[model samples]
Target: MSTDNKVPEIRSKGFSGEWAEEILGDVAEIKTGPFGSTLHAKAYVEDGHAIITTEHFKSGELPVDKKNIPQVSEDDYLRLKAYLLKVGDIVFSRVGSVDINALVTNKQEGWLFSGRVLRVRSGKIIDSEYLHHELSTSRVKKSVVSRAVGQTMPSINTEILKITPIHFPLDTTEQTTIGNYFQKIDALINQHQQKHDNLSNIKKAMLEKMFPKQGETIPEIRFKGFSGEWKNLTLGDLGSVAMNKRIFKHQTTISGEIPFFKIGTFGKQADAFISKNLFDEYKAKYPYPVAGDLLLSASGSIGRVVEYKGEEQYFQDSNIVWLKHDGKIDNAFLKVFYSMVKWSGLEGSTIQRLYNKNILDTEISTPERQEQTAIGNYFQKLDNLINQHQQQITKLNNIKQACLSKMFV
Candidate 1:
């Protein structure tokens, strides 16, 4: 497992970092996508030929969902079959979310291409998978992002794509080996991602059952013989929303401290992370969220809720609202309630704007303090399990990436 051994370093140029040249155009025949109306999907029919587009490509592989393959008549296939996709053909997104790449794996014989994507076919000098990996690397991604020309939605044309420089091993066998290795890694990452998604669904189901419905006083399941009606309350009556006023100019030096979370960090479950430092010299200007404060994203990505676990060292000023609960209301209960509100579409602007006042006005039904504790504790355990699985998936993906970087070279 140790990657300590030094491997061969191949420069793009023939010389050692002095006369670097472009790897793509030299090794592949890059073709601009068809622009004429000859490739329209209306020409396709049921049981039609497979058609590829930017939408079909996801995370370096073709996604099965959202597939839009159209059936081309035998006559039409003759006119357009040249653009039909084959195994090993590398597809690249040329427009929105530019530079996304996918390798064709499904061997089913009839696949076509759309105008939004480009096909990169290799010459005798290069392997298709190797070139695909080169296009997908972080270095290449940066280059592609830089080379993309448009101001609003940047994109790279086929000509620019052909000249895009890529670094790779000179040996063909090594190239194929590296390509195949990363392919396996990509598959594993997708698998873990799917499992993570399933676990999340399970947690959501558990939450729905644990919490009472709107205006319902008693939960479907109660502890032992205990039974009590939950109370209805307005968020403003239970707690007050506080906005952070401080701002941080620099985020680079703030790493090991607490992360200041903007509304962007809020997710369906909790705030993704904490801020480490505050830029505003006035320390008390922004509301400080302690271990029990409920953090809600008040703007963009509305309705994300997270309980402060004392992990973040700091916070920032953005579209964020902090809810400090009164002693009568449990913080955990508030967290669950916020989650329920989000699920019910109660908070956030009437027009999708997220603000503190919108959340304050949200109506909530709450059980007694003891019952709230029980429900919160139940969901907390479930959330912990989901987090554990997520951590494992992260470790596995990191291992895959390391293997990719080392095995390729």
Candidate 2:
């Protein structure tokens, strides 16, 4: 696993020569950021010169989002000019999350690094983007993190970073080619991420507009031919909170015939399980969620809603409850409504735990059943698109990791 090995297990076609190995110090100029005294908080201004902090490093790229970045006055920027970032410069976190690093592109050029960052500007020997991909490899990241010195809050210094070993092809063209290949993958990831974020924002907007604001009977937006003001009613008018019969600690096993979901794993994979005999008996006798029923988290991250598809799963009592409702409201409509509901206790206090009364008594303005179905169907389609984009992002990232492992020493 050492960089001393010149030939990687995988490489591009027409590239046969052994890769070169050298300590980072010999291939790049390493520098640390300014001291706290040199760059004080009071020196920052509304907007003048940007200062790159460890927060700016995300997905191995510098200044992922430039908005709201700390800025300094022109005079202060000149005083701390030595810490100025340049294109192709790579920055690393000096304290906490010491292994994370990012490459500076033209967008971040001339920006100054904050007190908690370390900078590495590459020499003529290595391609900066290629080195970024090299350092991003799991092997190099683990090495860097292991070298960082601190038990509670790991930190790295310029001296330690300088000695970090880096391996790369001798030819600059190969370096650029390899870098460019991954760059395209990263571009694709960013493109999908942008679409994901945009879709999420659109959903947010729709949620706000489609639901009635407090003190109002109608939402800002609605479906055609559904023009009348919505009905105002407490959740109790539609349903009551119901939960499964409790299964004590002894009744469950780590791995068993049926997956058991607790508050911690309400909408996720189950960590506990029950025997088939217990599941069959309890499901027959106890209050069980039917298909299309909305199973919700009543504790821990409260208000998380998941539509049950009649899966053979047992949920913990009280901690995960669902509304046993009449068919007045569509489940799809109710499911999305759960996303925006604000839980409050008696006497109008914000609740810590979602008591059954809190859920049943919460006031809501609901459209007629038909309009509810249309709104539900619309948001559901948007959610499906968002989920598809998210899945694509995850798949692309996995491919990137595989390439990073095989394409580098």
Candidate 3:
């Protein structure tokens, strides 16, 4: 098919039809919440009609507990009952850099929208689910924010919202099909996300139980073959730290062939780079990270680690700390043990930092080489599974975004 017409550039198979252009005022009734002063902090109470605000902008079923959201009296609710939300009504936050909206389900019926929100009732023209999905897409959201006015915090008025364009298929059945498809996708995304969270919690619990706590020589749990007290060792005993060479900002280039890595760029692509001459000169003389070594970030997110993967890169000085092993430790074993470590002297400190000397001086517990290898291998497999699940969720989300962009006009 040719691409010049109003037909979407891409869409789901078996439906080559195009969407029709419509305006928001033609298909929906738009209105803002009560006046700013009408709903104040003093209006909140222990129990009554729940006042939905930007905080509860998440569209879907509300939680059973409600988590102690502020409420209002019956009289106040009756007076502002005109602003009460019902099934199929979508509400948006009037202020904020990004446009935030929530679809009011049957469960959210009878809840009043606070002054900061704008409620849009799709009047028999557009499907509520489809409209919400359309508004959420980057295409429409950027348009919405572009019209917002402010120096620091951009905001939209109801006039700009009313004239906002809406484009979809003329057929209501087609609208429902698009809406239902996305609704199911959202549910699937939520399911995978919950599984990812559960797996992470399991790993954290295992890290706690399988390792020895402070002042204890033996772990609470161990592998099948291991049966004895763990060994005591300071970090210095495991390996010595190799510090990076001092490279000034002027020596680095924004666009260079050699990748110069800092603590910020560990595990990510390098934004800064050094000349080939500089890298080769430093690689031989200075104490630097090499293959089979673990890179420790000593600032910002202190103690974060990433292993050197034989990539061609030069490290930043003082910011990154690397371990030069002495054949007394396994890299995998050090990684797992580091995850369970609780750094001291960081409390109430303005700038959180872990100097190389302090990390080297910290005491740790360890098991025999065989047991350490087994435990490390097991967790590595578990981590691989976690990454797989998380990657699947990300892939699904990307599919949803691609569909939304092509399925709508």
- Better lDDT candidate (1, 3): 3
Candidate closest to the true structure, highest TM-score? 2
Give the runs in model 1 whose Cα sits over 4 Å from its true position. 1-26, 32-36, 41-50, 65-79, 107-109, 123-125, 142-151, 204-230, 236-290, 297-304, 310-330, 342-360, 368-371, 385-409
Q: Please, what are the lDDT tens digits per residue for candidate 1 over residues 1-409?
A: 1224223333232322122235577877766556657666667666645666776665566755324554566777677767877777788888877767877766533576777888888777678887787677666777778889899987878887877877655567667776777777777777767777787897687667666765676666667655777777778777787766645455434343444455444433233333433333334555667777777765556667766676534544646667666566877767766766753343444436655566667777877788778777776776777787678778877886565454433
RMSD, every candidate, angstroms: 7.2, 2.6, 4.0
Q: Predictions ranked by lDDT, top down? A: 2, 3, 1
Best by lDDT: 2
Candidate 3 contains a number of clashing pairs equal to 0
Candidate 2's TM-score: 0.93
What lDDT score belongs to each candidate, Candidate 1 first?
0.65, 0.87, 0.79
Residues 24-43 of candidate 2: C-alpha lDDT, one tens digit per residue = 99999999899898888788
What are the clashing pairs of model 2?
A: none
What ranges in model 2 sit over 4 Å off?
1-5, 254-256, 346-352
lDDT value, residue 107 of candidate 1: 57
